[model samples]
Target: MVLASALLATLGLVSPVSAGASKGVELGASDTEGVTTSATPLRGTRGVSSYEGTGVPSDVTAYGAQRVPAGHRIEGYSSPTGDDFGTQSIIGADGRVRVDPTTSFPARATVLITRTVSGVERLHCTGWMFGASLVLTAGHCVFNQSTGWYTGQLRFYPGANGTTYPYGSCTAATLRSNTGWTVDGSPDADYGGASLNCSIGNTTGWYGAYWTTASLNGTSTTIQGYPGDKSQQQWIHSDQVRASNSLRLYYDNDTVGGNSGSSVHTVRADGSSGCSGRCSLAFHAYGVGSGTHNSGPRITESRFNLVIGWR
Candidate 1:
């Protein structure tokens, strides 16, 4: 059985293995939680999923599926935008394509994070909705060593394509992160989340997440989120998992600064062993420092349960 939320609150940050990680890790009972797999995410809405077929992709502006969901409410920025926080590295050529409708399954589930920097609200990081009111992201996106939790400084906009906010926006009633990031300052433990003031995820849907002990190399991965350079529009890139360590996964998917906190996920087929549909594998955080590949904190059994408990 899953642990209760109260117990989980004190369990995070026990250790901090991160992207651009130091060494290899071994799987343990906690890696799989005594089971082979688990799917702990609220993934799709019955009538609100947008198109993921085609469009301008990167920055050309494909206005095809700009449909907006009705009834959901809406609701902010900073540094030189994103300076030292979540740093999404771009690999080789810029092959990222703009997500045509931002309203698609994972696209709508994806979010654009902004914070106050140098007196203005600017694009900061990326996030993904995992529950009705939970948005997971890089720990750095919500907290800094010098400043601390950005309680009133951050905002989450789901399916934000340029000037359009199809699903409106949401604010955090509480900001959360593990001690690994807040105390240990570990990048491996860099992932964190927020509990929104609104339950807009009912209309926006969310991304399913799972944890596995098997090698993920060669598994097709897709990174879709708002890149800082894209002027707040959502973009996407696809690549296979290049390497899978115990705590981090590497890939060649192209990304930029603001893509931090984006979900590094795979499209598992229907009725797959552990996860199906747009299932998240890792949390995008750092650039190409762990090697030639970009990386993020992997979703292990503990982290997976941690997020679910947060919800």
Candidate 2:
């Protein structure tokens, strides 16, 4: 009874999702070629081993993020929670729990993104490893409708602990997004990704994604990645799908700036048809201001195939 009693607390489920459409999209997604199963995580190899910010990368100097300075965090509101953590009003009393060993499964697969501006680098957005050299993130993370693609302004750290470079870091070989966001600036299409120069996914593994023409309203979703308030430390929260529109998903899983691009995923049992394990349902992109629920671009058949082709 003790373990059972502790279950809910351990899960730290998020508040109820707001009511909305529940219909799904057949994403025509991944397999031997579709979903790539996560692998056994490797220990921190970039710097010396320690529980916290002990591992060091050659290029990084700061170990933790500042209190998310204004103009530093996000580019703009409802753009992508990647850049700002202006106040707890956005995250809702911080319902997130920290993941101790950053080297665990999907935690190791999640990524910390840093973007440089005006000669300074800061915590930017969250990312999910979807291929050996590919990391999928928010559309705004790599492209700005006003200024244009961030090109060389971003750096990626997989399984990055507060100050550690457990998986080292990698830069983009190519930054990619669809015309929906790049040209149209659609929030429902606010998703993008990077093809890294290194094949880190071979060791860190990657997330599996799928889509279907069914309702996703009740499927439990967990959002875990680097949060701004906790410095560069990884944190997590969970909730069921609040609603799923043709191009986006809404949920109550608390998130803020620096949490953008985090995977909104569900754990499916092994041997499931198309996707199993840590199967991602959508990209976490916004907070409450985006219409009563945190939301992000939901993968569709074309979107899934497009991203997979990039991988």
Candidate 3:
């Protein structure tokens, strides 16, 4: 049985493993020195190059047909009073266990949740960069009294460490979670709940809602995230499943806290069914990490529609 919310409150976010900073790790390459040739970019076969690795496990594989119940929920990692919602886990290219990579889709829709604890500001959870001024993450990450949202200090980095891309960060102006998520930890009701009208202590202004959908299940995808408490830690994993709107992947790899809000992406390999070179099809915005059961959730397009419409 899962731990109760009260029991989980004592289990603050687990610290993730750390990897020294390097703009990004190179994937599927022969050596780190040469001009670096991009691989064929196969959906399920591409290897992650830049991020840290916890050593891949032998169980990683395509998902089976287990569906997450609509009633599944978890206690908020940061919020003592909030309920925890269920999410999907992913494996990074480094073979380390991480959260869903689909969250990185649409590129600019991912964000990093920075907060203040005991007057000391620190990076807390991962989030999605949505719209020109919106970022999405678990509501618990922002509203938890244990971790105060640093309205003025929060930042966002897109494709944070892609080997061929320059890194950038964005300042967050607002934060939002579903009213239900705030009440009973049932964001499942609003799994893709998003709002551009929410705010964080008036410092961050609301942009708009951007949630995910269940359409991504059974589709091939990739997951990226900073795990084990290391900033700049990233990984990529593929060959996934869309189980009840959640994207599930496998990796014996390990992940800890500070990985929340990682992005899950759809693989668009070169010469694949409909893909060409280096292009990702679509990505979900939240990195629900690998759990005790070896699964995670991916936000879907339908959820995004609901968030934008505040449905």
Candidate 3's C-alpha runs over 4 A off are 1-94, 97-110, 145-153, 159-168, 187-217, 245-255, 268-302, 309-311
Could you give candidate 3's per-residue lDDT for residues 106-205 as a string of tens digits? Answer: 3223344445445554556655433323455555555544444345544454333321111233444455654444555553432221232322111211
TM-score, every prediction: 0.73, 0.73, 0.45
Would you list the rank order by lDDT, best first? 2, 1, 3
Of the two candidates 1 and 3, the one with more favorable lDDT, higher being better, is: 1
User: Which stretches of model 2 miss by more than 4 angstroms?
Assistant: 1-93
Please write out the lDDT profile of model 1 over residues 172-224, one tens digit for every residue: 88999889899999888889999987765656667777777778899999999
Task: Compose the digit string of candidate 2's lDDT tens values, residues 70-163.
Answer: 2233222232333345553254555678886777677878899998789777889999988667899989888989999999989888887766
Q: How much is the lDDT of residue 179 in candidate 1?
A: 91
> How much is 55 displaced in model 2, in angstroms?
16
Give one clash count per candidate, in the order shown.
Answer: 16, 10, 67
Q: Cα lDDT for residue 137, model 1?
A: 92
True-structure lDDT of candidate 3: 0.35
- Candidate 3 has its poorest 10 consecutive residues by lDDT at 16-25
Model 2's lDDT to the true fold? 0.70
